[model samples]
Every structure is written in C-alpha cells, then in structure tokens.
Target: MPMKLYGVSDGPPTLGVRMTLKALNIPYEYVNVNFNKGEHLTEAYAKLNPQREIPVLDDNGFYLQESNAIIQYLCDKYAPNSSLYPNDATARAIVNQRLFFNMGFYYSSIGAYALAPIFFDYQRTPMGLKKVENALKVFQIYLERLNSKYAAGDKLTVADFVLITSTMCLEAIGLDISGYPLVLEWYEMFKKEQPELWEIAKAGMIELAEYNKNPPDLSEMNHPFHPTRSVK
Candidate 1:
C-alpha cells in the first residue's frame, strides 16, 4: 500500500511536507483533511493524530505526526543517500538545527504574532510583532554567517523545504522581507530552482493571506489552538 498524507493543501506545514515528498520523488496518496470544514476535528481523524494536527503521514501501519518528523522519516527511509537530508553526522546535525529553529522560533514567531491575531480575532501587540522581527533578523544572520544558498548549508535539505514555507508565510502576511536581503535572494533562488514546489508554496501563501483578509465567523467553532479552547 502507498503511503498516505493527511493534510490540506494551503497549510504552511503541509506544504513543507508536500515539497519534501515531491523533492524526494516519493509517491503517496494525499488525504485532504480540510480544517475549515471541521474534518480534522472528527474522531476518525483523531485516531490518526491525537493532537489533531495536519500533515500526518501513514506509511503502511506506522503513523507519524508533525511535518518535520514526517519529512525526515521520508528522506531517511525512502532515500537514505539523498543529499537533501545528508548522511554525514555533522551535515545532518546542521539540518536538524535549522529544522528546530523553524519549529521552535521561526514559524512559532509568525504563528503567534501574525496568525494568532487573525485567527483568534485579537489585536496584534507590538511586542508580538517584535518577536517576529527578531526571528527574521536571526534568520538573516544565519544566512550571512553560513554564506550558503540554503538554510542549513549549501545543499538544499529538508530544512529548506520547511523554512521556505514559513518565509513565504511572512511575505504573504504583509511582513517586510525586504530588510533581509540575503533571505530575499535565497527565497527567490529556491523558488526558481524548484518551481513545482514553488507553486504549492505560492498557493498556500495566497490562501493564507486571502483568508485573513476577511476572516470568517470563527466564534461558532472551537479550535484547539484558540486561546480559550486550548487543551490544558
């Protein structure tokens, strides 16, 4: 049986997984879990991921949650020798560091500062925006320090797949990416080099931006990420 990916097309994390899958030329069945339609909230979906997150990968009987974990597993299991994930300990460590940055800082900053206000119907505080700005500044420094074309290093790894989507989210949400010249250059080059994945990134970015333009009545729905609805 082919692997199954459960996610929506317009999610940043989901797009990252999709990019990784395509880059590795791995064939899998996409099982859309449209959160907007409350599909992900169903008990059936919960069986696959108790966290109720998208981008769950089901490879035969084994199920994996978290986009980064899924992508790494794909590369490791399907294409162990692929440079996109590297076999070298030091090189792979760098990629792992970048991926951690994305999960713990980069994407989290935007999710808190930008997406939170839009999704939860709250005003974005200056402090929140400052956190996001700091993340971008650090990202720029990483590029300049490493002097590499990609996030982790010179090679395009799983880190790039994850970072690029978050970067595009920053751009789509009207964040000024112009200040980070290196990030802008790298982002453009990544898109140019992988046009197919770029389409998915572009679509997800546009979808996010457009949805936030006139946010729907989320009051009727309870999201796990919502401040009041969050699980303790």
Candidate 2:
C-alpha cells in the first residue's frame, strides 16, 4: 500500500515534506487537512497526532508526525544511498545539524515573527522581527562556512528542503531577503534547479501573500496555537 500523508497544502512543514517526497520520487497519498475548517482538531486526527500537527505520515500500519523526522525517516528507509541524504557519518552529521537548526531557529523564528501575527490575528512586534533577522544571519554564516552548492554541502539534502520552506515563509511575509546575500543566492539557485518544487510550493505562498493583504477577522475564532487566544 502507498504511504498516506495528512497535511495542509499551504503549510511550510507540510510543503517541506511534499518537496522531499517529490525529489525522492516517492509515491504517497496526500490527505489534505484543512486548518480553516478545524479538521486537524477533530478527534480522529488527534488520535493520529495529539499535537494536531499536519504532515502526519501513515506508512502502512505505522504512523509518524513532525516534518523533519518524517523526511529523515523517508530517506533512511526509501533512499538510503541517495546523495540528498548521505550515508557517510560525517556528511550525515552535518545534514542533521542543519535540519535541527531549521527546526530550532530558522522555522521557529519565521513562525513567531512572520506567520503568527497574520494567521492568528496579533500585532507584529519589533522584537520578533529582530529575532528572525538574527536567525537569518546565522543561516548566512552556515552558507559562508560550507561555501557549497547546497545547505549541507554541494549536494542537496533534506536540510535544503527544510530550510528552503522556512525561507519561503519569510518571503511570503514580504521580508527583505536581500540583506542575507548568501541566502538570496541560494534561494535563486534552488528556484532554478528545482523549478518543479518551486512551482509546487508557490501556490501556498501566493495564497499566504493574498491572505496577508486582507487578513480575516479571527476575533470570534479560537487561536489554534493558544488556549485563550492571547497574543504571544
């Protein structure tokens, strides 16, 4: 049986999983879980992932959540020898480091600063934006040190997929990416090299941009990230 992925199309983590699947040419069934409709909060979905996160991977009877873990699992199981996820201990270590960076710093910064205010109906704070810039600067330093064709090294890896999705989120929010020259260059390279992935991820980005232009009134709706709908 083909794998099943429960996800929201426009979600960055979900898109990262999708991009990884596409790049690895892995066959899977996509089950869209609409956040707008609160499908993810349903009892059935919560049984699958108590956290109510998207991009839950159902591989036969086995189920998994968390996008980065899902990506690494796929690569380890399906594409062990693929350069996108190297088998070498040292190289793989570097890739793992980058992936953790994405989860801890890069994606977190984007979510807190860029996406949170727009989607959850909060005011954007200067402190939040500064944190994001600092995260970008760290990413820029990574690129400078490796000085390779991709995030982990010359060869593309799951790290690229993870980081690029977060970067795309930053772009969707109208951040000036030019300040991070290495990131900008890397972004352009990824666009040209993986045009199809870009195309797949772009629809959600366009939707996000449009949504930001005229945000919905979430006063009546419960904030999914918070219990009391209080801004963080």
The C-alpha TM-scores of every prediction are 0.92, 0.93
Give the deviation of candidate 2 from the true structure as CA RMSD: 2.5
Question: In order, how many clashes per candidate?
Answer: 0, 0
Residues 38-87 of candidate 2 have per-residue lDDT tens digits of 67778899989988878799999789999989999999999998999899
**Model 1 quality (TM-score):** 0.92
RMSD of each: 3.2, 2.5
Most TM-score-accurate candidate = 2
Model 1 lDDT per residue over 1-75, tens place: 899999887777899999988988888999988666567777898999988878799999799999989988998
Could you tell me which residue pairs clash in candidate 2?
none
| Candidate that would win on lDDT | 2
